[model samples]
Target: MNTVTPPKERAAAPETAPASRRSLLKRPRQLWAVTGPLVIFVVMLAIVAGLTPTFLGSNGLTFIAAAAAPILLLALGQALVLNIGSIDLSNAAIAVLGAILLAFLLAPLAAAAPLLVLLIVTLFGAVNGLLVAYAQVPSFALTLGTLGIFQAAALVLSGSTTVYVSANGEAISALYQSGILGIPMTFWIGVVLAIVLWAGLRFTRLGLAMTAIGNNESGAIFSAVRNRRVKVVVFALSGFTAGLASIAIIAQSGSASATGAGGDLLLPAITAAILGGTSISGGVANPINVIFGALTVALVPIATTAIGVDAQAQNLVYGLVIIVVVALTMARTRGAVVK
Candidate 1:
């Protein structure tokens, strides 16, 4: 005897099949999210090793780590800004400005100069946060304006020339020249910072707020997350990291200039963040994998040079790599927007 089932139960029973199928289909994308960037990095290194044969040697590895260190630092800052649905075009500028300030203050401030520079940049970044949060300014336009402000300040301070760190150079130089446990200090600092930031994102209230806000601001607000405060802290962290990166730059070069590392590093830093699996659409970031992304970028120019590619061709390779990687890593969820 056929019995009439309740309408609610009948409707609910059919939903499970499609839901299970979706779950099955989603597993591959989830897996790709975790492993894809790493696979690309490994494959690139393998290709380079095949061409050079000596690319896997200790010296080659060390060079890659060292070169990637500063880029990683800059990428870390960029990732923090990106995670919250914002971008900081001024991070590299902040680095240059910090470097110049550190150099100028080293003689008088001595051991305290680095701290002071970090504080200044952090505060500068907070200002950016304030404008974006309270004043309702768009991050892109605000940061672009601040980028000019930072560059102008850098130029004025450095007299449009390189500011050499003759006094207290050792304090900054040790960050790049010295090592602990056979790893360069710059790389060590980057690794430590990455771990710390990763932990924050994985196990902290602030991190949760950032993720929620980025994914859906209205929903996050409904959840009682302090979206504006979290943004301020995020930008402050970005600024502090930029200052840290400036220290690495100054240490590596023994000087700071307006048109030096900062100007050249913005593109690579942003590329590293995106390639590291940070979604440009916001609400996604992987700090640890960002290290791999930085390594890949660091390897590019070297690989190109080793393969007899000219500088112009090397740039073309960078552009192509960015485009391909962005396409691969972009989060394509329903209703996702790139802006």
Candidate 2:
């Protein structure tokens, strides 16, 4: 009989080897996403400590906490917008307008001024969200347009001048100057807010919807997610936080200015969010991690000074850090367009 013996079945080992290797490779990336910001913060702190021993003192640490507080709020807001697959270029501008409004309303509204400012900015953000959700406007363009409008409005409202909260400044002033357990009150507020946000994002239905929409809007829609409502809420939160940050700014400076309210904060806030492991392509964010990012940014100028670098070179260093971090964390897929 010429019947050949059946070919021995191929071993399953070769087939599973590549899959196992891929699983192993994915783990490091997952770990990196969680720990990268902390690593960077520690490295930066070490460098500063090595170069300038004075930076490890109580006063320096306190200053960093206070200075980073406002940026932390702004970055938290930016992180929300980015999570929803959108960008709010107007957040910084919103802060400026809120400061102007806060300055004008404090005497008349008293303690209610901050509350009113928060409401106004939240509504302002809702409008942006409405246009993006229902009107189908691209967020980048819409926010860019609103940025110009808000800036112009601020200039007109403040008459191109700084507004001082001379009479009723005490309430706002306490936010920055007061400390609890050796930390600034402003820092405590930021920390509390971050914890609340983190809890909401981790445990709520709204957070699930946000992640879904960011991951795949069409899929989210198919899955019965109320995409528009979620977006509106997300942007409203962004605006609310911006307003909160404006209060912090006024507290720190004891006054508000059209130029200084937002100032160079927009870029730094975006950088902080990104550095904190919030994916720029959306679908992920961590308010807790973002605190470390804010601290990293606040350390930039201090780090530069500690290392004897020129002050003007700070922006260059920021640009470099942003580029490197983005390159590493950006999501990539087949046929994905850069736009």
Candidate 3:
């Protein structure tokens, strides 16, 4: 009888749940993470456009696109290496080498020049892959060594002089200076390559495996990811991109110099990759952000000149911006798991 007593009223429910709807928002830091760089980029663009009216004009736009193409291509290569927790300092050197070959060796072949350059690039990439993947050398050391070797080769080939393509060298010039649909050909090539890489990274199994290896090699190995093979492929792709970039540079300048593209390109190329939201520690990559980053870096110098800033000051500012971006990215990624 007692047990049947109205199922013992559950001790009155502890305080009733609050009735007001609770709204949640992203943390302030997270908001800044996305908006800070975007705001700065927009502001910079506005300032440049205001000071150099040409910046908003077709000619200026074309110039920007042309200038950005090589770096964007090189940055894509760098981004690939970085994604695998490696670095390729030899990109500019490879580009310079390819330019020299194009001017001296392949130039005679005319229409076949691009194919020969592509072959050379593939070879260079293969070597890098073999050494890094098979020989077990640290990427930094290996690439640095190759950088010097490639530069020396370039110098020997160019003989302390610039190799000029005839102004009317239609085929060679087309690689760099020509365009399709009112856009520079080099620019178009870069856009296409970027799209391809972005798609590969997003839609392919190899891309997923590479990302997994980059994020954690040990974990990837445990999970049966073929790390070595993937890394080799990545290095090869980087080399191919560098080679293509070299051709573009040669076309733009209508010449190849012994110094190659010069070391001036190295920092900027790396900076673009780092600033593009690609992890330096290796993981996922953002090609769209990389494109924007390359454009921003290219525009800095253009804007500086248009605004009458000294070259030295421009370099200083560029360095500062890179450092700040890297620091911010590191802070956000530290102690956080990527996958």
Candidate 4:
């Protein structure tokens, strides 16, 4: 007598079919996932270029690169902290504080800007790490508190006024304004940082472990991951990045003010991280996409001016664009889940 296949085997056969179908669908989804934002960026650029030929000029490009450097640096820091399911609101304040410190204390060591900046940033990072990791406070609360504290410290250091980078203007300028093989220094720095971080996340065990911790801290702990240590390291790295950003700002603007501690930066930095496909809920980060996100954010003002939009209106447009993109991404993500 011929025996039919068991029902369980029949079910397994259909499951395999669905899996193959899902894989086929995944390819297009992945393509759109990256291409959607890219397409928007190109459209925006083309519109701006059509409106104003100067939009593509060398001076305009330099201005965008220079302006984007500090924000890009800060976003990179935020991205790192975010990758591990944590937030760092203290970035702007930390940057201000670092700039003040550099102007007053480290400027004398002109020959050692790189080394001095590294040490100061390391210390700032360690402080953040200790408070967040060992103290067991939520990163949001911890960083928020530190934000105020650091801002106050910056004010005190600057005496509540802008501190000009006149003393070491040449050195600072060289750091931010000079070019390497014709590429702007600031642009090169951002590119290098992005590449290094991308490599780390792709090829390193620590990077995989950080993703695991971010995805599920409790589960990662059960699987023997050092969650606390990893979080601390991530926070420290964030601080370091903030410090680097501060140097860039000081170099480019030649001044630091308390007013600069909170304005036009917080939202965009977070937006860049999210828009780059780094999950707001953490667990995933794409450095390459983040670079594009940075470029997109940086281009907004240029585009607006080229198109003759008022500054206030441009701000509104930026806020609206961020909201729309985020909503779309969320909807697409949900659809994928349902499907």
What value does the lDDT take at residue 218 in candidate 3? 92
lDDT of 2 at 26: 78
The alpha-carbon lDDT assigned to residue 134 of candidate 4 equals: 81
Q: Please give, for residues 30-100, the per-residue lDDT of candidate 3 as tens digits.
A: 44443444555677789888887776774766777788888988899888888888889888888888877
lDDT of 1 by residue, 239-281 (tens): 9988888888888888899988667788888888888888775
- Candidate 3: which stretches are off by over 4 Å? 1-40, 166-168, 180-182, 260-263, 327-331, 336-339
Backbone clash numbers for all candidates listed: 0, 0, 0, 0
- The lDDT of model 3 is 0.75
TM-score per candidate, in order?
A: 0.89, 0.88, 0.84, 0.86
* Candidate 2 backbone collisions, by pair: none
Model 1 RMSD in angstroms: 6.2
Per-residue lDDT for 39-101 in model 4, tens only? 666777777778887767646667666766777777887888888888988887787788777
Which prediction has more favorable TM-score, 1 or 2?
1
